[model samples]
Target: MLTKDGCKQLRDFTEKNYKETISEVAEGVWFVLGAGHSNAVFVETDFGIILIDTLDTLERGEKLLGIIRQNTGKEVKTIIYTHGHPDHRGGAGAFLESRPEIIAFEPKCAELEKADLLQDIQKLRGTRQFGYSLTDEEAVSQGIGVREGITHGERRAFVSPTTVYRQDTVTREIDGIQVEMVRLPGEAEDQIMIWFPQKEVLCCGDNYYGCFPNLYAIRGGQYRDIAQWIDSLDKIMSYPASCLLSGHTAAVLGHEEIKRTLGNFRNAFEYILIHALEGMNAGKSAEQLASELSLPPEYAELPYLVEHYGCVEWTIRAIYTAYLGWFDGNPTNLHPLSPGIHSKKMTALAGGAQNVWKTARKAMEEKEYQWCLELCDLLLSNDETACGEALLLKARALERIAEYETSANGRHYYLEYARELREKNKKG
Candidate 1:
């Protein structure tokens, strides 16, 4: 968790460097930041312009495109999608006035089409993860990247791809500039990297960002392929690019700086992978390995590598889960009862729900938030009368944690649950 000072420092730095606005990344390439929610890159060429990723809504896209017109006065002739994420490709239709050629990986397009099957659940989880339900002050402190508050009505402006490629490397020459669409599946199964060979500028989608890469999203999903993610980093590192741009955060300039940044990013994952594998081999439990794994002091010192997005402990568990199943080889866990069953029994042993609540309130007063939450959970599980008071305690505990959370997502998760609890209390 970040200290209050740490969060304020990061928030200020981001607002100054990469916050909601349009900025030039290279000679002909511009990075359009949708208030740190997502980024779209546009490359100017003789024919017109090649756009990479559109902002979330048609309104935001048109607004950004207007800025691009005033700056470069170029019409968009082509569009490239880094992945199927809505924030990256949602405003695609806003450029239809130029009849631009839209490009995306074949599988990514398919995923978007099938995403509707999980629409309701995904949207609900997304709302919480993004803190869309929170007030301005609460939401701003929740996470990094574009912060969404106002809703855009009739927002569907996504354009179907006119060109879909399946190869690992798809080459194209838009007007006069040579562009290579390199498939590097990390973050998402069909994620791609746009490499402008002539300019020696790389647009690294979500694969590379200013913060520690999210190896596993807390909102929930299948385990990310850490090996593939590491390999993707290696592939991008091999490029002798002078500029590195991403779908989130600010651009990385200069050849040596880009090289060093990519090298360190790759090394961080390698260290986690190697140590976790070693721990597993030595018969360490997943929990034990997660608690023990830590990045080197040098890696830890890099502000860019801070747990702003993903934490080392979560990465350790994810790697362990990927290599081994959920069994964890613990006999008790293999046949454990439901969570509520354990909570109910634990509450009884602690001298009934009232005793647990009294103890929890005392812990809360002492700033022992974790212990308060655990004790509150025990009481809430067994006694309906304690729901209102228990939820309040949980909310307090969560908010306290949020105040010092270093990971943006981690802070969001804490505050989001607290908000949920407060809402539940209002209902009753």
Candidate 2:
């Protein structure tokens, strides 16, 4: 029933992201089977099962549904969404029609409701930079992920929450099982967690997945509240959890293990968020600030806080925006010249396009990526095709720097841009 392109795309995606092992944590509790970007956890009772997270795609969901059926014949009684991200909720359509009631953290509902307001915050910042003349394939090929990465953040018109809860704390008994949710205001304004008190089970959701928490998604939105994220970590630490699960990645078990990992996570978020604010408050320029700052030694030592999603530096910027708007408090920037206007003026002042290109390459050679990228943007904006030479150069420069990237999102951005340059050359 699928078209050739659809089939190929599905096959490619699946091969890229299929899980081999699904863990059975305990009786009536199973880690929802998945690998990469999404996870689902199911809790079973005499009546039925409560599922958390719904895979990432409808196609992916269909595959997960088939897998879930292979595991158990019982019907799902409810679905709990930890947050409103498409990766977490997009695949819910398959689960809903199958007869499960949907439950979501109340703040996630707010996130989903203003959902229209939530556009892929990253992509908005990116495409608005040039235009969507860039296709998904084009974006992917160019290594231009992040704000202009692949998918639309647009919510799929599918199953939404049937019930919601509000407040910093909420608890419930599900068929004699006690679950507690503590509101964490970091990642999203209304985000919280679903904790199984009786079981010492903590489903941190997107909050502390193995990957570096997406402290700042390139697809723009409100700068993620890192301070709130740290506080959320502290709250989770208070729980005597025997097992800790995330929206993606494997389940981490044992009180000592969970405590150690969660402790590092709290420290990392606190370190990144606090340092970013402190640097900005001290009047450090963006580039100067990034150079001077580093993650706390303790956080950098932990494997749990690895940069799978959010980069340490970008997270700092996110904190910067959270504390102060984008202006950088510079009066000169209050009425700065526009990109096109400024680039032209800078070009004229520098003598010519070639002069600017030469200077940028020099900065790049010295490994001053920040300055190099800044100049490259100016040249390219003046005339993209004219700056085609610089575009290819920028890509090469980004590729090397990306090797040092800690977060997948940051690497995606650098690599995508590099790929784009290569593709453009082939066409030219």
Candidate 3:
């Protein structure tokens, strides 16, 4: 539950960053931004319309289709997915009436197949990450964009790709339009960018958004290849694109601005990668590197590099884990005590659980919310039978921390956990 002030902050953030609108980015290319988060591109060609990446859920797809109908009566002939992300290709069922040829990279189809194998767990984690249970007022923006129409509707309406491309680059002439789909594995292994040479427009899906790229999603997924991500950005820069259509946020119009934004974005990633490796080689743990590493003012101050969607510390930690396994080269961490036993030992050292709770309360009074959370965790872990008050305290600490968190993903996660804790307290 967000306080009035917290709600206001989120609402203002959304209003300033994620306003819903549709606009013509190029001559015949129209960018449709739905509910702030999901974006779909409509390319009007000679024969019919070419749709790139349908919005998530059946309801969102239907609404987007209605919008398309209003703009042009041309039938949708082809649908291209930028990646295997549900938000990118889940709404293909909405465009099936025309029997469009749905196309996706071969790796993307394989990724989707892997996702289908673990659909139940993925859906559960995704729900919590996206704050599906959050009310409209409580759920503000998804950092990249707004949170509307993302998880709505009972049926997702996903349609499998009819055409799969295995090559790195596939150039096809659809409806008298020459389009190139280039594989750029960054955010996802199957991620691809659509380039329209004649139009000077580039649709770099999930590769470049408004804010810093989510090199690591807390919702949990496969490791994003940092090297491939940097290479993809370089590939995108080689093209002289006057208009850039991103998966999220508004389409950037102007070659110079796109170049500058992409350049800074790439530089930020390189800085994190280089510094994280240096710190690891210097015998610094992931925790130490995460705490110390940060982007300089030049990159940090940029709007695109803002830690809204992805934090610098999270990326540093991810880089460390990717290069070196979880050992951290610490002998003690090789076989750590179980959380239950560890908490019990700590409580005994503090004289009792009551004393630990008192200290946590004191920490809360001092506004050290993170410390308070750790203390409360100790109490709750040691004695579940008498953790009612400690649970409430932890919930309060989470709310306090969430009020000040800038990243939407982190904020929503804290709030959701707090809500869960409060519910457990009631049931207990």
Task: Count the clashes in each prediction.
Answer: 10, 18, 0
lDDT of 1 by residue, 48-163 (tens): 88988887777777876887799889899888999887777777778999898899986532344465688788666767666666665665543347564233243747788898
Local error of candidate 1 at residue 78 (angstroms): 0.3
What does candidate 2's lDDT look like per residue over 192-310, in tens digits?
77888767788887677654666776766655666667778888878888888877657889989888888877877776666676778789766566667777667764655644455
Over the stretch 1-428, how does candidate 3's per-residue lDDT look in tens digits?
A: 12335445555656786777888888889898754256899899988899998887777788788888888878788999998878777677888889999988866424434566777876666666677777765556677776746544435678999998889999999888999999998988888999999899999999987777678887776678787799999999999999999898788889998988899989889999999999999999999998888899999878777666677788888888889978799899999999999998989899887788789999999988889999988987875425688889999998888877667777777888888889999998
Evaluate model 2: give its TM-score: 0.78
> Once model 3 is optimally superposed onto the true structure by TM-score, how far is the C-alpha of residue 426 displaced, in angstroms?
2.2
Candidate achieving the largest lDDT: 3
Query: How would the candidate models be sorted by lDDT, starting from the highest?
Result: 3, 1, 2
TM-score per prediction, in order, is: 0.92, 0.78, 0.93
Candidate 3 regions exceeding 4 Å error are 1-10, 108-122, 148-154, 384-386
Give the Å shift of residue 48 in candidate 1: 0.9
- Model 3 scores worst on lDDT over the 10 consecutive residues at 1-10
In terms of TM-score, which candidate is stronger, 1 or 2? 1
Q: Which 10-residue window of candidate 2 scores lowest in summed lDDT?
A: 141-150
